[model samples]
Target chain A: MKWESVSDFFAMGGYGLYVWGSYLVAVLCVIGEIIAIRIRRRTLYKHLGLRKRSILRGEK
Target chain B: MTINWFKYASPASFYFLAGRMIPYFSIAAIIFLIVGLYIAFFSAPTDFQQGEAYRIIFIHVPAAWMSMFLYVVMAFWAGIGLAFNTRLSSMVASAIAPTGAMFTFLALWTGAWWGKPMWGTWWVWDARLTSELILFFLYIGFMSLQAAIDDPRRADKAGAIIALVGVVNIPIIYFSVQWWNTLHQGASVSLIQSPKMATAMLSGMLIMALAVWMYSIVMILIRARLIILERERHTAWVSELKEGVLE
Candidate 1:
């Protein structure tokens, strides 16, 4: 509602680049952190799974 | 009829509780982010002087606040772990590090973005800016110190000392603009004074701050759960969990 047109919204009164740049960095940081957590969790589970299997094999 | 306050002091119970709570926090974070962004971009009027450039404050202020708040929480848990020797407390302290560092980095990044146009420069060594940069380094130092140690107990104690010592910087960062002349402006939204921003703008910023709060809780909980598993791999409960749950 602040802008008359779509381009005007993106243009951000000619301060578009700075405003959007700050937001873009924020998005990247959030995504990067989530991805890092996922990778760490996966690696951990895989390691634990392997250890469980090895222990079972020894028992058998 | 009284709830057991110390029941969740154990990592095993906390892990399951965190797992169950993540979905709710994640939902709240997502919802708040959507509403906050909508208000920030559409509902809030442009500033008379700075125009759209002032919009950077939406994220910048929130990130900066979180950076400071998370450090205090991290240090609190670290201290509790040191004093009481609680494993969950230590795990929580360690889990908060990377996210706190991320927010600190975001604050600096967004601050630079805001400064480039408004101040005509990307960087300054003003008291506020310099102190914030030091806070960032403190987070990095805590993480690196903990990572350097092989034993978890020693790492937690070492990190706690650094975190507690670094607490002196938070007040400095908060009052830096007042204590000395600086390029960075004084706080617009303070507990002691009425906000200088428009109602809609303040609401949007506050909502975004809540969204960030929920997001941080989700991240820290997830990270703490992972830490619990990593440290308790030899425990019977972890083995049972591994056998019962693929996730």
Candidate 2:
């Protein structure tokens, strides 16, 4: 709303790259961390499943 | 009335509690960030001196604060764990390191980007910047030392020592600008003094800081749950949880 147009907004009044660049790094790191943490949880569940399956097979 | 403080100390209970708590924190983080960035980019007026470059401080300052704050929290938990031999305490310290490191990296990276335009240099050996970099290394050293050790107990103890020893660096990072003649600007907002910036800018930065805090809690809780599971994998409760025998 502060900018006259969309271009002005992205330009950040001549500081577009610096402002957005810092935010981009933050966004990427956050997204990457979320994915990483979720993946770790998924991997844990998968390992549990494998163990359960192995135990069942051995009992049979 | 007596409070059973140790009730949640067990990993199994803490795991479920963390799972339930994470959604609330994550949602709060999302809300705060959206509002904060909107105010930062749209509502906050451009600075008289710095034009738009000052906007980077929303992310940079908060990240920098979190980097130092989290380290202290991590060290506190690590120290407590080392003294009392509390499993959850050490697990918490371990869980905090990655997020702490991430914020530290963000602080440095964003500081570089912000500096390039304003200071006309992408990097500097300014006391503040150098001390912050050392804090980053401290985080790395804590994590690496833990990973190198095979035994979790030993790893936690070793990591705790480093974390405790590294607390000295945080005050250094904070006072570096004051302690030494540095290129980095001193604090814009301080508890002891009136804020130097406008209302809108101050609010946006504070909101962003809150968002960062919420995000950290969510991440730390998630990672802590995972650490709990991995370390307690051999326990009956973990096996039962895996088998869906204990819901």
Error of 2 at B227 (Å): 0.3
RMSD of 1: 4.0
lDDT assessment of candidate 1:
0.91
Candidate 2 error regions (>4 Å):
A50-60
Worst 10 residues of 2 chain B by lDDT: B238-247
| TM-scores of chain A in all candidate models | 0.78, 0.76
Q: Tens-digit lDDT track for model 2 on B1-247?
A: 9998998988777887887788899999999999999999989999999999999989999999999999999999999999999999999999999999999999999999999999999999989999999999999999999999999999999999999999999999999989999999998788999999999999999999999999999999989988997899889887766566665
TM-score of chain B of 2: 0.99
How does the DockQ of candidate 2 come out? 0.38
The weakest ten consecutive residues by lDDT in model 1 chain B span B238-247
TM-score of chain A of 2: 0.76
